[model samples]
Target: MSETAVPLPAPVFDPARVRSAVEERLTTFLDAKAQLAAAQGFPAEVTDVLQDLILGDGKRIRPVLCVAGWRAAGGCGDEGPVLRVAASLEMFHAFALVHDDVMDRSATRRGRPSAHEAIAARHVGRPDAARLGMDAAVLLGDLALAWSDELFHAARLGPDQLAAATAVLDGMRTELMYGQYLDLLATGRPSADVDAALRIARFKSAKYTVERPLQLGAVLAGADVGVRTALSAFGLPLGEAFQLRDDLLGAFGDPSETGKPAAEDLREGKHTALLARALRRATGTERDLLTGYSQGVPPGPAEVVRIRAVLEGTGARAEVEVMIEERRRQALRVLEEAGLPPAAGAILRAAASTLIGPAR
Candidate 1:
């Protein structure tokens, strides 16, 4: 299997172009909301914060995958409606990120204050500032979600397209919420059950991050079950690889590079596949040290250093790397056998690299 599925997609299917088009649509949509808020005497800060968070730097992966799915399933011509739907996916993503940060109490994202943090910072001196910020951020996330719905409604899709897209969107939202719930339950309880950890990754990140987005686009193009099935076979494994890489990033990536606190998963005690595997492989004192962490031991600098040693010593980190590679290769093989449109296949293969390859 190819190590890297090189991407030379046509301009219309290019990831960069898809990202630019989606971002511009989001900016325009938010600008209209801002104007309406000003007219209604609503707080401008609402749109302002939404703008800063949604318009902030993003990989736009969902939107890109959606478009790729459409093209792969033979969608073509007059991409205006498709772009609008893509932008709505991004709005939905902003909702997910805002709530995710609030849930994790994450301080920063993409190198800036998370939505809750930014909102709290705005009212620094108030006695209820922290609580107020959390409340406001929750509201903001809901508003983003509602607006995403409105955006989708306004996409002017044909009746067939709308019905198809709605079914996929409904499933995606439900899966994402349940995935998050699973993750919440599992947090602070790292375990040796690698399958359990993997289950969380599949629902919490894999499906929404890859599978549904692909299906959403394909359905919009009136894709048959065969095309959607093929995409799923390719997407699920690749999505798993994506989440594994994210676990590694949260465990060990630099703050400057990852734009978040270091060892966040460790600090939060997320029961990730990486942690699960380490627990599985460890022995004696090393196993105890690893178990101590799963039991809520503070991951202070020295403690984290020791845990890192355990992760390395047990070769769990290395094992996870091998897992990622295996998943990636599986997706590549699927892509090859799926016999998708050449251009669409190229776009997806390229996405695989960006999703699981070395982080930018």
Candidate 2:
């Protein structure tokens, strides 16, 4: 008689487990990078700073979504390759955040000094310490980007998978740069153009943050067009909601929780959806106050108070909350219809909740 054959249990989707796995891979990979840098006589600061940023506090949303996408697309084998690619996305994010901080002149990230700020402190005695910090941080950001590519290549994906992943990544990077450029031009000149604000959110956050990462993992599993479409249907709205939440946090969140200064968005004159709504709906002194602040002037504490009052009085804050809830619903609806495995769908729902639910 032939021996009885038994099937292994299907893999369950656990967001915490996925996050842990991705974090482990990132730590290990960056440790190796640190070692290589030392061996090559590279500045210890480069590796040390990167290690802090990469292994520090983050939700690891992109990587978790990547794994969730793979699971959703019927991937049922080793997670080794998937985790590597996911880690690459985190590295790329580190690059993005570092550059973003430099551009915004932000002093804090993850509740601590940003890369440039930290670098400056290290060379405090130098006459050109500030410039040196900025330049070195830029190089560090570049290195992170390059190392991200290295991570992706080192994943050793097959030719077909590599091609697919490459296409998505290239598009994501291009979209991000274009979005940032657009944002740069619009900053300090914010208008009531809700559509334009949403456009920025789409490219800067929706596609780059949520959609592409999901697509990358889906393609890795040989997902079909339907799965790709489903991921987009779910990803776009959720990503927008995520950014909107960020805008709110930037404006009003407790600095202790958000790891950044409150009203920094107002100070930077970011053309966010919230600002657009305030610009549209505010009247009289509220309108003038918002208009004045939107002209690129950094708001002092009193000015920030007035701006917050306008944001609240104009109903922009409440409107944004509603928008977030609606987007969350839309994403959940798509997840329901996607016909993904039960576990995968649950994980996606959890991710959506994490993105749009509340501040952490």
Best by TM-score: 2
lDDT of predicted model 2: 0.87
Question: Model 2: runs farther than 4 Å from truth?
Answer: 1-8, 291-302, 358-360
Model 1 regions lying over 4 Å from their true place: 1-12, 283-300, 358-360
Overall lDDT per candidate, in order of appearance: 0.87, 0.87
Name the lDDT value of residue 6 in candidate 1: 86
Q: Tens-digit lDDT track for model 1 on 266-286?
A: 667788999888888788888
- TM-score, cand. 1 vs. native: 0.92
Error of 2 at 104 (Å): 0.9
**Span of ten consecutive residues with least summed lDDT in model 2:** 290-299
| CA displacement after TM-score superposition, residue 338 of candidate 1 (Å) | 1.8
RMSD of each: 5.6, 2.2
